[model samples]
Target chain A: MLSIKNIVKQYAQHRALDGVSLEVEKGSIFGLLGPNGAGKTSLIRIINQITAPDQGEVYFNGEKLNPDHISKIGYLPEERGLYKKMTIGEQALYLAQLKGLSRSEAIKRIKYWFEKMDMQTWWDKKVEDLSKGMQQKVQFVATVLHEPELIILDEPFSGFDPVNAEIVTQEILELNRKGTTIIFSTHRMESVEQLCDSIALINRSHKILDGKVKDIKNSYRDNTFHLNYSGAFPAEKAGLFSIVKPADSENVTVKIAAGKTPNDLLSYLLPSIQILELKEQVPSINDIFIQKVTQLS
Target chain B: MNKILLIIQREYLSRVKKKSFLVMTFLVPALIIGMYGLIAFLTVKGGDKKAQVKVIDESGIFAGNFKNNSSVNYITTKESLDAAKKEATESGEGFVLYIPANIESDGKIELFSTKKAGLSAVSNMEKQINDLLRNKQLKDAGIDPATLKEIDPDVNIDSIELSEEGEKDSSAGAAYAIGFAAAILIYISLFIYGAQVMRGVIEEKTSRIVEVVISSVKPFQLMMGKIIGVGLVGLTQFILWIVLSTTLTGAAGKLLLKDKIDQVKTEVSVNEAGKTIEQVNAEGPAAKILNAIQTLNLPYILGCFLVFFLGGYLIYSALFAAIGAAVDNETETQQFMFPITMPLLFTYIMSFSFIVNNPDSTLSFWLSIIPFTSPIAMMVRLPFGVPAWEVALSMVLLIAGFLFTTWLAARIYRVGILMYGKKVSFKELAKWLTYKE
Candidate 1:
């Protein structure tokens, strides 16, 4: 669990982050969404303690952040790398030790993770010898090697292939299930729809929307309906309700007016058409995302 | 603190295991030994070429006086000047020396050869002819040649160094050699190791691993770890070089100069028994060198060398590491590197003249007190016996200098490591220094 309050960072003439705030809950997957140059990285860097904010306070588990919290927070920067000349096992051990793990404990955990990822053969191989996707996995292992309380992944899935991406997704889910708080920034709204429990959308140095995914979708719902009929055509007034899809004998989708109730609409159309099915349409998170971003921009 | 150690361990192991490190550590001493061996080999096998000199001697005062040594042969004959010159060119064997009839007054002669004669050959011929002409002149003046030879003296001034404790019969030449070598060694190691620290920083920045590293460790810790680790690498190489060179030199000396060294040892022992009654030259040259080495406070020089070497390295390497962190590539490093290199270059050149010629000069005293040049200047003066207070003051200032630069460097490194994809000017760096930790 982590909280950042009123973070402002200034770089030369550029205000990288202007008065942004965020909170990451325990045992939940939090998606941080923003467009390019939206100060997502500046916010993340403040949390990771890479660079201090001009005016802000970061709290870890309800205490002021300090150097002791470094071991508790794991950061995988977007532009991350390993020492190319150092072997995988050695570099991992060195990094793990830097995170406060004892040498023996580091080696044991590294071996387990390497075996689990099917990367045991790369233990003695130098990082430069690996392909981009393979190196990403190693970096991932390094990020989570200490089993940190909170893991911050910046663009974790960019360089990975689809298969590797699936694998990483599963690993993230697994970590969340094990009670590790996760905060990841990405542009893939589809993935966020599939995986995120909560999200904070930042745009143009402002937090426009943030809440539980299902609740936010509920809030952005449009008055729409899907209908399934058995026998006849509904001789409804063309101006009353807009037919959303091409007419079908067994099914139809429609958008009704805001003032009308579903029961009132059903009663009004029951005599003309044999009514069988009626369902309200709820927008997808992607639709809400696009709608909200366009509205704010 | 423990993280710093881990970082240091990683840096040291990663570099010390490289193939370049091992190759250079061994290769340098081998090359040095090879060069020294070549010089010794050439000296032992002196020139064996035989040179012939034909004299025309129109003066008629000297005949059969210019003789032959092992390498040069003198041929005196009563031949015409034209015949001698023609024979000299066609024969292709030697030179034709023409001593004019006015030689006893003029003190000048001409020699003709196909190629320019060797310096040693010409000087030998001149010595032989001049000796004979000088005696002839003395006899004509009615002054006995034997008495004139008795009065001719070779100057041998005994150089005694005056010290606060007492006078010491110290060898000025030996002191200069030791002082010069120590000063040069300090300068070379500082540059070598300091550059290594900069290169290591540049490597980390380019590789982008520093981002992840600083998340777990402080930037100050990272910089200090790297500088200290690389310094250890340089120290390791230096110690190995000393050990290897000593072994190599000893083995080579035994193999090539066994008979010569043993002969000198026996003669050295005989001179040692009569040292108090005899002048410095009465001892063999080798014996004098051995005795001078014994009189030197070698342990003191060595101890001070270790102190100043590390102090100087720490002070300069902080600047180098800062420069490395400020720039993205080696090309961008040039602008900042000039200011750092100027002082080092100044001291290296000064070691040959200012520091060596007068350790007590005003400029030398100031140079030895300023932290930038003091490491070399102080070492140069230390062998000649610096006052204890001056050495102590230099030590204090050097430590302060290292701490100051290290603190400044860490400030730059803390901000600069994360900055990428931009040309960082000096103004940007100056702004970074004002940033808060």
Candidate 2:
């Protein structure tokens, strides 16, 4: 669990984070969604204590975020890398130890993770010998090797192939299932939709929206429905509810007019057209994100 | 603290384990010995071959006056100048030395050769002719030639250094050599290892691993760890080089100069057999050098060297680290590097040309006291025996300078490491210092 309050980060004349506040519930997958340069990285850096907020405080697990909290949190920056000349096993062990693990413990965990990632033979290979995607996998393994209470990953799937990305996604879910909190900042909205229990969308330097994913989606719902019917569509009797789609199509979408429920549109269309499938079209987070960002601009 | 140690260990081990480190450690001493051997060989071999000089003493007073040494041989001829010139030219083996009948008044002599003669050879011939003429003039003036020789006695100055412990022999030349060598070593090491620190920082930044590193520890800690780590590597290599070079050069001396060593040993033994003062003085130079080396306070010099070397390295390497962080790559480093290294370069050159000779001058005193130039300037002064308080003051100032520069560098490094693709100017770097963490 983490709580960030009124975090303001400034860089010379540019403001990286402007009074951004958000709470992440315990054991929840929190998606920090933002466009490029939308201050997501600045906020993430603040949470990880890589840099301090100009005028704010962060609480981790009911305690003030201090250096001791560094051991309890793991961070994978968007621009991640490994020492190209160092062996994978040595590099991983060093990184794990830096996160406050003992040397032997680091080695043991690295061995386990390397085996799990099917990188058993890569222990002695230098990072330069690995492909970019392979290096990303090694970086990912290093990120979670110490088993921190909170894991912050920025664009974690950028260099991973589809299969490896799926594996990593499963791993993230598995880690979360075991009671680890996850905060991922990414531009991948579909992954955010798939994995995040709650989401915070930041625009410019401020948080525009945040809450349970379902609640945010529900709030953005415009009461639109997609109807697939066999009978002739009623074009004239649709005054109470406006048809969002063109009138000639067999499968059409409609929006209920103000002060009217879905039942009103159903009753109006029943006599003329027998509705086979009536599904309320909930706005995807992608659509809501674009709409919200465009509206702010 | 543990994380810092980890970072240091990685930085140190990664470099120390490289093949280049091993090669440099061994190869440097060998190259140095080889270069010295080459010089020694050229001097001895070239000195062994004597030049043949055909002296045509038409005045007949200079016959049998010239002596043959290792580098020149004299062959007197009685023929006319043309005949001597024709014989010498036909043989093409030596030069023709002509003495005119009125040589005493004119004090002029001529030597004809196929090529320009060596200055020492020509001067040797002139000295022989002059000595014969001078003796003849003395005899003409009713004075004994032997008495004239006795009047012109050889003089040698033995410099006795007065110290608190009493008077002892000191070789100013030896002291100068040691001081100059130490200053040169410090200068070279600063560039080699300071640049190593800079390159290490650039490697981390370009690889984008610094962010991941600083997330676990502070940026200042990372910079310090890297600087100290690279410094330890330098010290290790230096210590190994000292041991290995001493051993290697000792073996090489025995192997290459065996005959010379035996000759010196026989000369020393002959002196032990009741030789005259002249013979003893003939062997005094070698013994004087050994005595000078023994009298040098080596432990004290080495101790001061280690302290100043570490202090100077810390200061310069921190600035080098800042330069590394400010730039995107090695080529970009040129702009920032010049200003930082100017004082060091200026002091290093001055230490060789000016400070060593004038170790007690006001310029030397100030240069050795100021932290920016003290490392090299103080080293050049150390062999001449610096006062305790001056050294202490210089050391204290150096430590303060180290801390101050490290603080300045950390400020620049923390912000610069994170900035990507931005052409950071001095103004921009200054602005970064004002940025909130």
Candidate 3:
């Protein structure tokens, strides 16, 4: 678990982060969401201790964060970089060792990851010689090579191809499954819904939203149902439910009126129409994200 | 500390492993040796260039007195001056000397030739005519010409350097060469290794690698690692050059001059007494040169060299790293570099022109004591033998200089490494200096 309290970071002319606070539960995929220049990177950098905050305290599992905690954390910056002239294996080992791994351990873990990622042939190839996506794979493997308790990846999938992105996603899921806390900032709402368990949305140096992913979606949901019917469906007015035009021609979307349950609507419409499908429409994370961001903006 | 060592290892290994480093290391010493060999070759061959002179002395008293030597072949002619000039122009290989009948009263003479001769040739003719005239004057005055030759004295001042220990023969030539070489060596190494440290820093920042690396190590550690790493590379090349040049100078010395020297010794040995006197004059300076070199406290000099070498690299590289971090690319670095390099360039010129010539002067003394110019100026003073206290003071100031600049540079580097896209000015850099880590 990680807790950031009252973090304030000021640049020359702008305050990159202002009085921001968030808590990430242990072993959860925490999505850090923000628009451009919203202090997400500043918060991430503060967490990684790349830059110290002007005034704040970061506690890891109830202990104040210090240099010792560096071993417990791994950070992969969004704009990935490696020594262009160095071999892939050497570069990986160097990064792993910098995170406090022993030489032999770094080498072993690097080899295993390279093999798993189908990069065994790239061990001696310089970073400049590799494709951008291949380099991204190497960067990803290096990020997790030390097996830290918390992994912070900033836009890890930005330069990755679709297949490579899926690979990264699966690896992140596996790492989280094995009790690793992950913090990734992304604009990809689809990925947030698919992978994140909890999220904190930061906007303009302020924490505007924070909760469980399912709870946030559930809270944003209304009493709406997507109804599809066949044979003898009434086009006329209904008493219990209001019919809304479906964006598509074949399906009809309807909202249940107040003080009405799904059973009331089902009973009201079952006699006249053969219902092919009936499902409650829960808001996706994308819809909740856009709606909240729009409201806040 | 371990991480710093790792960074150093990476920097040092990456550079030392390059083929360019290997080639440059050996090539520099070889080129220097070849240059020295060429100089020695020219000096010996230049002395032996054969020349001929046809003398038409109408004065008749000096016709047979001008002797013939292997280097300068003389032929006394009876033809008129006009006919001799014609012959000289047709020949186009040598000069025709004209000594008129009134040459004894008027000390004027002329050389007529189609081809231009060097000043040494003209001076030789003057010496011959002057000696003949002088002997004739002594004979006419009823004085012994042999007694006058015996009375003439050649003044050779035996230069002795006085120290607390005692008097020792001094060779100005040796002192100048050694001092100039030391100063130049420091200047070159400072520029080379210092720039390397800056380029390394710029590479990390421009490529955005600093953020990832600094996540685990402090910015100070990274900077020190790079400075020390490149310093080691410079030291390695220098040591190799020293060893290689020593060996080549000895081998090439013999290889370049053995046959020519033998031929000159044999041919010029016919005038045994005159040639032996010339050798005595040359031998005195040569022996004094060896004595001067022997008086140099080499271990002491080497110790001071090592200290100032690292000290100079550290001081300059600290600023270089800061500049690299502040700017986005190499071109942006030019404006910032001028201030840092100004004093270095000034010290270099001062070492060559003023410091070595007058090491005991007040200006040279102050230049040696100042930390910024001390590396070159002090080394230049070292061969001339600096006082113990001044040497120690300069070293202490250099250590202080290293500490202060590194502290200042670190403050700037910590903030500048993370900055991008902005054109940073000196004002911005001054502001960055106050930023906390």
Q: Return the TM-score for candidate 2, rounded to 2 decimals.
A: 0.93
| lDDT (CA) per prediction | 0.84, 0.87, 0.85
User: Over all chains combined, what TM-score does candidate 1 have?
Assistant: 0.87
Kindly report which residue pairs in candidate 1 clash with one another. Answer: none
Please write out the lDDT profile of model 1 over residues A1-297, one tens digit for every residue.
788888888876788888888888998889999888888988887887888889988999999999889999888988888888889999999999999999999999999999989999999999879999999999999999999999998889989999999999999999989999999899888889888899999888778888899898888766688898887766555545767786777888887766777777787788878877788899886777678788887
Positional deviation of residue A210's Cα in model 1 after best superposition, in angstroms: 2.1
Model 1, position B291, has a per-residue lDDT of: 68
Spell out the clash pairs found in candidate 3: none
Q: CA shift at B428, candidate 1, in angstroms?
A: 1.2
Which candidate should be chosen as best, given TM-score against the real structure? 2
Candidate 3: chain B TM-score equals: 0.90
What lDDT tens digits, residue by residue, belong to model 2 across residues B240-269?
989988898888777777775576577567
**Model 1 segments more than 4 A misplaced:** A10-15, A225-255, A259-263, A266-281, A290-294, B47-116, B261-296, B353-355, B381-385
- Local accuracy of candidate 1 as per-residue lDDT tens digits, B313-409: 9999999999989989888998998988898889888878677888788988989999998998888887677889999999999999999999888
lDDT score, candidate 3, position B360: 95
Between candidates 1 and 2, name the one with more favorable lDDT: 2
What DockQ does each listed candidate score? 0.70, 0.81, 0.60
